[model samples]
Target: MRRVLSGLVLLLAVLAGTTAAAAEPATETVHYTFDGPSPLTDVSGHGHDLTPVSRFGGAFTTVAHNGGQALVFPSPCHAEPCPRIALRAATTTGLNPGRRPLRYGASVRLAADQTTKGENVLQKGFSAQGSQYKLQIDGLAGRPSCVLVDDRRPQIHAAISNVGVADDRWHTLECRRAGSRLSILVDGVTRGRATVPADLSVSNRRPFSLGGKGSYPDNDQFQGILDEVWVRIG
Candidate 1:
């Protein structure tokens, strides 16, 4: 009788442990569907407010994309000292996903006449010197490509897509970092992947900029339309 009782207790304990593990909170996900009356706000209930980096020139305007509103960056007066939109300080604090896995995705459409070489679409960090990660539609070899960079010197580990993305058509670009591997996907297709430090983390007090990095000019500004930006942290 005692042996049967012990077996029952062990079964209950195992079941309890499984239940507890399953009850753990899922990943935190934030999505921005640019449907708004004026200035855009994150509809993901994450409280991330998009603000203009500059008061004047670089402000984003609302345009239609896929039957929804999208943020558009008009032609800038100059490539350097251009205006940009971003979420700074307090707004970016919750983006710290610790050392766990994270993913960033955006729906972008390049202008038909896009002549710029390096147009930054999304980035998290203060400047090139302080960059933790960045995703840009750049013309590295005189051809448009989607590039993803982490905190690496010379960026040799940066992931570059095999196909060009600046076709003036809407495309979904995504970067996912899991364990020590980083993968870049364009339109649900894997573009490239690279191995990064297992302990790589972007948990810092830096502004998460869209359209471009606030400090850099010339190559970091994005001139196009952006919609449905999403971020997930596990």
Candidate 2:
């Protein structure tokens, strides 16, 4: 009887441990396949709508990519002024991950001649306010690289990847913020990382913008095809 009681106690302890682990919050993921209806919608059931900024003067279309459909941003240049394709959500309440650890992933393919200066791939927040962060490619020194910028503080924190992204090729890009460390990954490989404040929070009242900041000009627009865009937070 004593031995059976001891075994039961150990089994109960193990079950309790497993239960606690299961109680932890699961990773929340928002994926945008861009294969939905016109105007693009988040298929992850998050109900985030992608709206185009008409003032930028660029149209969003679906093009071919990886044997499927992907959102394409044609050059926004006409003659004198070439605005970049801009699309963003009206609110960041359920879209943003707040101050918790989060990861942003996307499969992107740049156009053959899409090397525009200061072109942004993904960003959240405005330039006027100090609470903004961005994940960009090839916006630094005209090189094909991944850049993560955090502007929540007085000094801007940027983490740039060492590997250069090839043009006209599909590549998986990811930026992860775990604790105080921000890491940039290319094709599932960690390329760059920067140490930020542990309490650094990316929370902002502004809406989350994609392709580029809504208030900014076309110089920072993104000229490429983006697919499988997702944001995971825990």
Candidate 3:
């Protein structure tokens, strides 16, 4: 009976160890698949829905891509008020990663000809204000980069990728913030990385913007298709 008791205790200890070593799943802060009529709807049950604020009525629309629906922003936008969407700062909840490990990304498809001066895929807060997180395709290169400014610091931590994603192919681009490290991933592979402050935290009262900032001449508009945009905070 003593041997049997010892064996049971050992089994319990091993099971406990295994449970402790297992990884915990990240929480879905907000997600938009852009697969249905309600493309701007946040299906993650977080109620972080977006509102379209484009000057051109047809700037924001849906197109079929990759065996599913994808949100489309006018190529070149040509003029001001190019396609854009936003979530109000007051309504944005569980979207800020304050000193937390965060992962946010999107599936993008852009032709080379669609490149713009700057394209904002996702942004919250403004760098000028001192605390922000932005995922944007920079310059005419169409290379995605992740920017972080935390703790009201004026300095910007940018992780820029060399790979241009405007080849008319569906590529998954992700920005990961793990402690002091920030990384840019293309197609599930790390393409760029930068070291940030270990205690850096992003918390601000700024509306989340996508595709572009506004109807300005230089909204940094995105000219492409985006799908499965998500933000996960852990």
> In model 2, how large is the Cα lDDT of residue 171?
85
> TM-score, each model?
0.78, 0.81, 0.83
Candidate 3 on 60-164: residue-level lDDT in tens? Answer: 678887777888877665555544443232336467788889999999988888887678888888787848888898766689999999855779999999899
Q: On a 0 to 1 TM-score scale, where does candidate 3 land against the true structure?
A: 0.83
Clashing pairs in 2: none
**Separate clash counts for every candidate:** 1, 0, 0
lDDT of 1 by residue, 1-234 (tens): 999999999999999999998976467666778886744677778777676665345566788777879888857445345564443324465776656787888888875466366777766653345336667777633133333334433243466777776677888998888878888898999978878767655655676667776633443667778888888887
Residues 48-103, candidate 2: write the lDDT tens digits: 76788745466767887666688887663636556555777767655455567878
Q: Is 2 or 3 the stronger prediction by lDDT?
A: 3
User: Which whole-number lDDT from 0 to 100 does residue 83 have in model 1?
Assistant: 61
Supply the global lDDT for candidate 3: 0.80
Distance from true location, Cα of 33 in model 2, Å: 0.8
Q: Looking at candidate 1, what is the lDDT of residue 61? A: 76
